[model samples]
Target: MTEPAAAPARPLRRDVAAALLVLVVWLVPISEGAIQAAPAAWWPTIVRDLGSISCLFRHRPESVSYYFVQVLRSGRREWEAIDERALFPMEPFGYRSRFDRFMERFGHRSDAARLDLARWLAARDRELDPARSPVVAVRFLAGAQRIDRARPPAGRWHKPDPGAAPVRVLSSHDLRESDRKDMSEETGKSR
Candidate 1:
């Protein structure tokens, strides 16, 4: 009788490999959270390196509101205030992404960051209308609204009306020195 042929060995399945890869990726965020919660003394060098990579995964989400004041020259003697969103739309993907990044780094007590944001808005306004001058300012707003998770699933969630939510103004920046100088020069010319 002929010897039976040995059954061919199977290679690793594609589905299994993919599942393993997903699991490893999921572990990154969990490990990052644990490291963040742990004491600084207990952190290892490798954990620090991993934490940097895990920045893309933000476990804590906060609601942020951005408000702005836009001043436009309606006449030589009068200036009009318009809604900032009307002048500068955040609907574009690139602008929205950059704004989000700026908010991520913004602090309640950081005047420098607020000044930078004001400068950026002034520059953008100038770029949009080179023939005219406008003064633009920005304020950072944030608030925390709690949800009642203890209630039934159908009605467990509650969100305050956006207009009604009390917002803390973290920072505010007005016109820069150069802008003030320009305004003064224009006033002199008008006189």
Candidate 2:
């Protein structure tokens, strides 16, 4: 009896191999996610290949309160939003991701950190803009606004009444007082 001829071996094309590699790279996170016991166990990843469901029927919608840094520049009576561009010069494109992350981590941790940040900001403002007044005081404030499901788009995002006060003051530092204390300590004198 004659034996059947063996088929010739073929090598995988470079493109095919690369495609397979890409697929595997994408699947690593997904495969690991499938075995997680809880939703939170799936480590937060930017890869949203499958999509995500947030604040759906699974979670009740609620008011969102956010923390922000408000600086009181010298000669200005009103406390306004900080000029992030002036503080973070490297981020010329406008979105200050570094500042945002720093702010998020700055939530009511230590008094020293808050004071240091305020002092640093004041110094930067002084060096950058010699013409304008530097930041004399820095306040870490919390603001809140609620979304009304029953209201129209115009009235959907409802802020507190004009007379309503802030939710709370997270932290505040007067740079002038800090500078005075530093100067006194440097001169070996107590304030």
Estimate every model's Cα lDDT from 0 to 1.
Answer: 0.53, 0.63
lDDT, candidate 1, at 86:
46
Show model 1 residue runs off by greater than 4 Å.
1-96, 130-133, 151-162, 176-191
Candidate 2 deviant stretches above 4 angstroms: 1-65, 89-96, 144-167, 189-191
List model 2 lDDT by residue over 81-109, tens digit each: 76665676574223433554455555556
Query: What is the alpha-carbon lDDT for the whole of candidate 1?
Result: 0.53
Give the Cα-based TM-score of candidate 1 against the true structure.
0.43
Best by TM-score: 2
Model 2 C-alpha lDDT versus the unseen true structure: 0.63
